[model samples]
Target: MVSIGEFGSKIKENISRVIVGKEKTIERVLAVLISGGHVLINDVPGVGKTMLARSLAISLGLEFNRLQCTPDLLPGDVTGISILNLKTNEFNFRKGPIFTQILLVDEINRTTPRTQSALLEAMAERQVTVDGRSFQMEKPFFVIATQNPVEFEGTFPLPEAQLDRFSISLTMGYPDEQSERKLLKGISDEHPITSLKPVSGQDELDSVLKQVKEVEIEDSVLQYIISIVNETRSHRDIQLGVSPRGSIALMETARALAGIRGRRFVIPDDVKETACDILSHRIIIKPEARLMRRTNRDVINEIVESLPIPINNEKT
Candidate 1:
């Protein structure tokens, strides 16, 4: 079986053909998917959010589907509908893009709250309901939903319930000067994404994902994760805190990160590294905190830094 590190490296190298100077971001996204969690990418347009999703799906050899969300997009459009079969005279179910292994929801905030709610069940349960029937999603299902942080004009902010369903939220910032230069040179007459290929097959990915769940973490580290979540609940400037789901997400992603780094045991650094991205979106800040320019990231960072690391690293 291929090691997790090797699998991650191959996927990252293959994706590098299309995306530039975002190794850390790629690693985090890979970890989230390996941990069986969806991603919420909050960023400005033209930063390769869609391209990144496509590259990752291709690298993993997953069935990829893109849904460009609009205000008019409906629940049935995302989850499919039941239609009458002409010959059989029975209602036949037609699958939507949500049935795919990897679904990229572009400009998700532009869709109505009703349409947005359609994804909640799929993201949380990996299944969709139509005509009072439940349909199970195939294994390795993942979502990479994107929203423009700078533009709110016809966009509806994701409700707290929707936000909490995402395992990790990140921004793919603009690449550095050298990487941008390489990007420009690589895209003369043709795009690099057109030539990208799958680095590993589904079986290998499944094996690696299984191993990620088996990655070990000490009891001390687990308590540390709980402490971080607890801090958010009582923080003076915060109106809401990270939920238990956020804690689980942090631990799961940390395990995946450890596996990706070729470690059988998770350490403090793994928890610390994955905490902000996993917990930031799950938090709700007060109006006063926003006026003070204190973002969720700031509060998460303060909590993470103020907490003490587990000195006991010996695995049980």
Candidate 2:
């Protein structure tokens, strides 16, 4: 069996074939996915943000599906419809692309809130409900939803409820010159994604997620988690604070980070390192604050800087 670190390294290399030079983005995606959490890739078009989602799906030996969220798109379109099978004299449920292992929900904000709500249930419960019936999803289910950061026109902003459903939100900006040059030269009759293969099958992926749950953390880490969340609640730059669910995600992601590093225990660095990604998007900024030129990134940095570090890592 491949070690957890080797497992992460192998998967990173597999996706890098198509998504050149964004190792950090690739690693975060892997960490959140293996941690049994969802991701929101925030960036512009033509940046391989969508491609990264596709590459990860391909590398994991999972069924991949892409939903181009648009104004006319409806909840039924994403969750599929319950149609009557005349021959069988019954209504059989035909599942949508969301039923797959990796669902690349491209341009998610373009669709109306009604359409977006279709995913809230599945994303949170790992199941879909149609005709008042709930169906369990396959193992290793993940949602790598991507959105355009610059375009808000005609875009329906995701509700805080929907946004909170995601575990971590990140951006994949333009790669450096070296990676862009490599992308151009590598194209022949095949795209880089075409030749990609899974590093390990679904079974292996499952084992890694199971191990991530077992990663331990000390009491100091728990206190650190509380302090960070508390800061978000009292910070003057924001109106709303991180929700309880958001705090839970932070702890789970921290543990997963520790496991991926081949350590059985988590440290303050893990929480501190992933704090921005894990908690930034969950914050609700006031309109006045936005007018005053404060970004969530800025507030996150301030909160992180103000916190005192743990003197000694005490075990729980």
TM-score of each: 0.97, 0.96
Please give the CA lDDT of all the candidate structures. Answer: 0.92, 0.87
Number of the top-ranking candidate, with lDDT as the measure: 1
Give the per-residue lDDT digits (tens) of candidate 1, residues 44-98.
Answer: 8999999999999888888999999999999999999999999999999999888
Write down the TM-score for model 1.
Answer: 0.97
Q: List the residue pairs that clash in candidate 1.
A: none
Over 10-33, each residue of candidate 2 has an lDDT whose tens digit, in order, gives 888889889999998888888899
Best by TM-score: 1
lDDT of 2: 0.87
Q: What's model 1's overall lDDT?
A: 0.92
Mark the regions of model 1 whose C-alpha exceeds 4 Å error after superposition.
313-316
